[model samples]
Target chain A: MRLSLLSDLNEERAARRAAVLVTEVGSGEQRLVREGQVGSDPLAKDLEDSLRQGKSRLAEQDGLQFFLTVQTPPVRVVVIGAVHISQALAPMAKGIDLDVTIIDPRTAFATPERFPDVPVLAEWPDTALPDVGIDPYTAVVALTHDPKIDDPALMAALRSKCFYIGALGSRKTHERRVQRLMASGFTEADLARIHAPIGLDIGAVSPAEIALSILAEIIASLRNERRRSA
Target chain B: MRSTDTDILKAAEAWRREGRGVAIATVVETWGSAPRPVGSHLVIDEDTNFLGSVSGGCVEGAVITEALDVIADGKPRMIEFGVADETAWQVGLSCGGRIKIYVERVD
Candidate 1:
């Protein structure tokens, strides 16, 4: 690899942006396709597929073979409460390599001792969420069950491209929450993005079981989104 | 950073900077029962040091051998292995799967 190309690749990595390194098999010629520049590339479809799936592969276009090396930012999960469910969910998310963060204003609950090594933001979601910078790869889950806290976080999530937004609540609670969101100027389409009564229906009874279901649902949503986009 | 491909690429880059010959082999495609996914990589330095896996022990030895040749010749080769083929058992792809790998020098 040329020094210039290596430096360019490093720049993309530093910026937390996605890119594809295309290497021609026969000639070893290389080019970097930054996420923003993929639209005009000749192998746009292949590059986009690699980005969406976060996988690299060899692609042949008109008999010209090229290796597409995919580089994606890490997936993130931001839990809105440092509750018992989060105690189970945080490590579970980490087990799957999702960067996890716990957010709550309650200092006693949101402690490093409770959620060791995981990022715990002791600020309100309205303040902390923006700093966290949710992106397309982020999964936002609201477990606080407190309207003041979860609602603002949900609003932030809805505005951004976070792939998954789930809230823990009963059907009745979600309906009432819906009325509040509607009154606050949220459209049906926006509200639909929230996975109310969050997590997969596995008849989960304990906090750990519920956490497992949430992670499963998040994974399913991610895979389904990729399939739909593909 | 969690991705093996990224780690392999970084190792290859470092090895190259250290003036060591380096080559990378990547799984380009796979068929039935392939253990490793496409895009999996195994990087080889001139000293035979390797990082990552292409087939979960099914084909790393073969890939490293081919990669050494690629490092010397600077030519990329696409190789295919499968369990259904006559040489499948010999090559150790006995998991009823096939994989296409592209090996190349990272120049």
Candidate 2:
């Protein structure tokens, strides 16, 4: 907990970069490993494992036990449509430790009174997604089936390394939507990333049920991706 | 507020910057019916002020008492707690489980 190390940790946090504070339990010595450096450090493999799981852990290397304190930025859930489903999804996402933001151009739907305590951005996705700053920690969800709104948002999310991208529609609707994206120059692999007919198939009949399914699917995807990389 | 690990770390840093001695207790490992996941944190200041949680409410009192000592002694230690069937009614951890928590001063 030296002043220099504190400054380093704060700087990385300000930059929204992931890092780990490694404390040698025996000696009380410490080191800050930035996300980029985790791949090359002597504890590279262990560090990567910690980062992938997004959990701090005690790692023993050569009989030396070190506490890896993980410092990851907050996970963001950006819902493109401030519709009924979003009304249910936003608060649920926040309940599970995600920062939720709902975006829609329609002021009638995207009202502060409707979504209390949630940031409702009354702007188009093209203008608002950049302002929101999508990153690997973000999960983008398109609740609106409107192609004009959801398409641009999907493109923006796909361009970045956002952890989850989901769009609300039926399987048939997704097939037609896939055709549109393909015509717009998206590859098969890129289009494959979208969780079309978004959410787990839980027989969700109500908006709240659908919202629960979507969040569950997103969490499952996040954990599965970590396992895949780990 | 959110009770996430990041919030615990931020609170620890802020408390230390405000000249309050801080100790952080982290759940290093858990086995069987543990309430909180490994890596969960409970940061306690010199005055017994704390944030976040390591085991829901199963063992905060014991952890906080150890955390106060850790902040004063500047020594780190691993402490283990387990629920036994004989004392299940006496304590809240009716479901049996064991957890190891690492307590250290945030210096």
Candidate 3:
């Protein structure tokens, strides 16, 4: 690997862009392919599959062997609350390599002291999320349980290609939220994307347990092949 | 804090920029219960200082030894380790897995 290529790869990662370092095994010849440049590469199909899955692998073309070092943007979790659950979720998510950011319009809750390790935005999700740059690699979780805060975040997530979107609520509460979103022109299909009653049903009662369940569900949504396509 | 892949590569580039001889060892292939996945990196400077893991510390000593030679010669080498190899007793994976690592100089 060349210094310039390594620097380019790091730049793409910092900018949250995907890239692949393709190296010929025998000759040590290498090239860095950015996300949009894959279409013109000789290993287009393999590169596309590797990027989509965020996995690296060895590929054989003709008689030569190549290693594809697939580098996807780091997975980010955007929580639209600085509540107890978010406090627990932030550190736990970071332990597993998920970059977490907390957003809450209430300055009282979104204090740096509350979330010392994670980024906390004392602004509404509509404003904060745009600067945060939600993309397919991001997971949005609304844990405020307040319509004023959670609803706007959900709306923003619904409009983006975020991989996971969940809102903390009871089933009845979700029904009301769904009706409101439907009234705002989101179809049932769009509403279906939100994992209301958020988290896997593990009978979680405590905030920490709830955070564990939510993280598990997010991992499932990320690694499951079927959900990746959906 | 654990070094992520990005940090490992960045450190490699930084080490080279600072006029240190650097090499990167990557797990290009794995079989069975490999401790680390393919594309996992272990960046080593000429002094044998390393960051990251290609086998969760299983075969790092041997990889670093080989990396020093790669950095000196500027030639890439692919090395394999497994229980099946004769060096298994010396530096093979304790997890009973086989891995192919590619060590190359940061030219």
RMSD of each: 2.7, 2.9, 1.8
lDDT by residue for model 3 over A92-130, one digit each (tens)? 998988999999999999999999998999999888988
Best by lDDT: 3
Give fnat for candidates 1, 2 and onward, in order: 0.47, 0.25, 0.78
TM-score of chain A of each: 0.90, 0.89, 0.96
lDDT of candidate 3?
0.93
DockQ of 1: 0.48
DockQ of each: 0.48, 0.42, 0.73
Q: Is the docking of candidate 2 incorrect, acceptable, medium or high quality?
A: acceptable
Residue-pair clashes per candidate: 1, 0, 0
Q: Compared with the real two-chain complex, what DockQ does model 2 have?
A: 0.42
Candidate 3: segments with Cα more than 4 A from true spot: A226-230
Report, for candidate 3, the interface RMSD: 1.3
Ranking by TM-score: 3, 2, 1
Q: What is the lDDT of residue B68 in candidate 1?
A: 88
TM-score of the second chain, cand. 2: 0.89
lDDT of 3 by residue, B58-88 (tens): 7999999999999999999999999999886
TM-score of each: 0.87, 0.88, 0.95
Candidate 2: list runs displaced more than 4 Å.
A2-14, A228-230, B31-33, B82-96
Error of 3 at A17 (Å): 0.4
